[model samples]
Target: MNKKGYSRSFISLWIGEIVSEFGGAAGGIVNGLLLYEITGSKEWMGALWLIYFLPSLALQGISSPFLNHVIKEKMLKNIQLIRSGAYLLPLLGYLSGEDYITIIGLIILQCLLGLVQPIYASLSFSLLPDLCTEKELVQANSLLDGTLRLMSFIAPGITSLLLIFSPIYVIYIISSLMFLLSYISLLQIPQNSVEKIATWSKKFWWEELKAGYFTFFQYPHLLKLTILSSIVQFAVGATMVINVPFIRGELNGQAWEYAVFSVTFPVGYAIGMLLLTKLPKNNLLMYSGLIGGGLSFVLLYFVPTLPLAWACELIGGILFPLFNAQSAAYFQREAPRERLSQLSSIRLLFLRLTMPLGILFASVSFLGINTRLTYLLIGTFIVLPGLYFLIKTIINRDSSAKHIRNIV
Candidate 1:
């Protein structure tokens, strides 16, 4: 364990995660840029994402049972290595100077990334409890979450700078190197940090898969958290689809203004990570974060100016980490240790499934909902439930207080 009370393994994992996230973010941006540069078709871009998301979600659904059967640390390292090689495909195609080959490479790369990400994420999440003491898990989660968000925030700017001096394909090489570095960082973790479950059968695989979902539903608190997280993801998906139109069209904002609006949330998220360490970790803070973030979305519906829109995103960014990191820690702590990997995969499947739903909700204009109204609807979806839970929490506390007073 380190001086901060985290195991060296955890620190290594954190470092690896940070590097990989930066690479992923930078590569994601360049993927779109390079694809658009080659094909110049919005439909193809959308199709490319579909190729990634459809298979990724499918794999996430069926892959949970396998997680509990594997060594998480090794799996994570292997994923990073695969990602490193996957990133090189586009660069290789570009070197060959064939647009079709480059496109094919990008498609293949996305497919590979899509398949591995769910497994990687599930393994890393399950490994977290092993990487730190129970007392240190929240802070560990916060640190990991914060730095990853920071990397996402930083990658775009750095990628843009790189683009100014080199071909776009060069970014892919850098991304590949980043993943290789991540793999090396992960290698420093002790091999025994995770133990694979010793059981295997075709029948057992089916049973474990069913058990993952069954066990998840058997825990109401975990289910509730997953649902809430899913709703947030749904809102996020909608925001992705509508933010451009609402900012540039409705608000008549410039490109720079829109960029600022896009960035404020992650910036606030980094700040929120710091703020969480100073605040008490409790249901109140967690629920309040959810409600506050929801309110930010609601406020976007009312904002008359571009700055207010930016403020809304910034406020949401600042508040969301409060709920996210704590809830994640809570889930990790509450989950049965042996089944945690399977359960983590189950939890992630639900979360991943919601984003595309939100995107569809926003994108389908036949619903006849305007952009602001969609914002209002998404915010309300979050806020009303949040308010319900918050009120229930307060009432429960009061009832307990009265009972205590009577007993005294």
Candidate 2:
């Protein structure tokens, strides 16, 4: 495609994702609050987090092959509508004055909504290469990253403010609206504009899945990237699952403080994305991981006050997106287009599974230790190796650095 053509498609996709992210952030805050309200127990709140993730871990693995075979654009549209409906489902239960049992049921429904996400992510990335040339991929990914951060920064505050006048249902209503609007924007995208295989061996499914896994392992560098990504994702998940309790109990703050803290990370993330737009895409992965690893420790150990925490979070926000954008761009560039979806699915499966696993580990550890101490220990411990590996990766790939410089 020409630059203009790519720009148009990138803008369309970016708008859809931004709208969807806004809805997602709103729904997340409201769901957690409602779950806490209904159950009135931190354990159950933790369980709610687990429930939201477990299904995606199981379903993404089980459905990977089938998801790989689907028509990418069509599947994305369907997924958006499914997500839109899922956002609306909680409203019915809220309106009906359902009890704890209903809340549990809604939690399960939310899990199912999450099950579609890996497939959605896979399709979205696959579309990017088709929509834009290789030279444009980095810039396009930065745009998507910025949109995500923007939504993350704004959505929670809006959701929390809405809660002041009304019950959590306001969040659900707004989330539903944003999701539907996202779906409408998605509809503007043309279907099956990218190339597809005409036919494959009946064994292709099994072979392809195996090949994806095998390819990931065969490329040691990529495998290392995936593992590091998983670790960082786990660290992120642990922090997020505990953030509400940490704010409310540890900091003696309200929901609004939680919103403020939430907004800070994305503010940092937007900064990172903006930086990526201007910086050369060289040693991006290594540098981003190093920054992220360092920031994680700072945010965990030294952010004694809300203001300081916000500062650390802003730094984390910046580094995390840089790591993700660079890693994703690298994978997209290196992976074979024919098997990209399957490869993407497997990578996502690891990322999803690691999150709940991290949360579980963190939750269990929290049972025995002070939350702050736990954060400090885990943050410092996990980050060091991550930083070491990231630096090693960059040094090992000196030629890749030279290639990156040439691109710039």
Candidate 3:
């Protein structure tokens, strides 16, 4: 263990994730840019995303049971190597000097990426318990989550700078190299620390899949936490569709102002990560974070100025990690060791499924929802439920205290 209280394995895993995340983020930026540059049609851009999400979601649904039966460290390393190879396809297509080949390569790249991400995410999440003590989980999760958010924020700026000096296809090479670096970093983790499950059986796969969902439903708190996270995801999806219109069109903001608006939430989230380390990880902080974040969204609907909108996002960012890091730690600490990977996959699937729904909710024209109204609706969606849970927690605490007094 290091002086920072994290095991060497966890640190290795964390470092690998940081490298890979930056690569993935940078690649995502170029994917959109290159595709739009080629087609010059919004419809084609949307179709490209659909290609990624549809198969991705399909795999997320059926892949939970597989997670239970594999070695996580090995799978994670494999995924990185696979991703490194996948990034090369687009570069290969570009060198052929054919737009059609480039498009096909993009389609295949997205499909491959979509297939592996859920597995990688669920395995890493479930593997955390083995790599760190239960006590270290919250801080460990905070560090990982914070850095990921930081990477997403940093990668775009770095990619933009790289574009000035290099060809767009060169970013793909950089992404491929980054994933290779991540694979090498992950190799430092001792294979003995990760438990190997019995070989998976095709005949029993359906049964295991059903059992995974059944076990997930067996825990009400787990269900509740997952739903809470989904609501957040839903809010995120809606914001993605509407935030540009809200900031640039409605508020008459410049491109730089909108960029500031985009980044403030993540910057605040980074600050919140530091705050989480000092605060007690209890129901009070968790529920308050949820409630506060929801309120920030609610405030966005009422903000008249661009600065106020930025503040709302910053506030949401600062408050969300309080709930996020702790809730994730709670899940990892509470889920059964044997089924953690399976359950983590199921939990992830639910969370992944909600964002698209949010996007649809915001995008559908007949819904008669305006930009501000969309904010209000999704914000209310979170706030009402957050309040119910927070009140329930308070009541449950009081009831337990009273029962203890009667026993005394």
lDDT of each: 0.90, 0.74, 0.90
Q: What does candidate 1's lDDT look like per residue over 309-358, in tens digits?
A: 99999999999888888889999999998899999999999899899899
lDDT of 1: 0.90
lDDT top scorer: 3
RMSD for each of the candidates:
1.8, 4.6, 1.8
Winner of 2 and 3 under TM-score? 3
- Candidate 2 residue lDDT tens string, 147-213: 7768776777677788899778877778778878888887777775454553566687667667668
* Candidate 2 or 1, higher TM-score: 1
The residue pairs that clash in candidate 3, if any, are none
lDDT string, candidate 3, 143-211, tens digits: 899999989989999999999999999999999999999999999888753455555688688888989
Model 3 CA lDDT for position 107: 89
Model 2 misplacement above 4 A: 1-6, 32-51, 93-108, 165-171, 193-207, 241-259, 295-308, 367-377, 380-408
Work out candidate 1's RMSD over C-alphas: 1.8
Please give each candidate's TM-score.
0.95, 0.81, 0.96
Ranking of all candidate structures by their TM-score, best first: 3, 1, 2
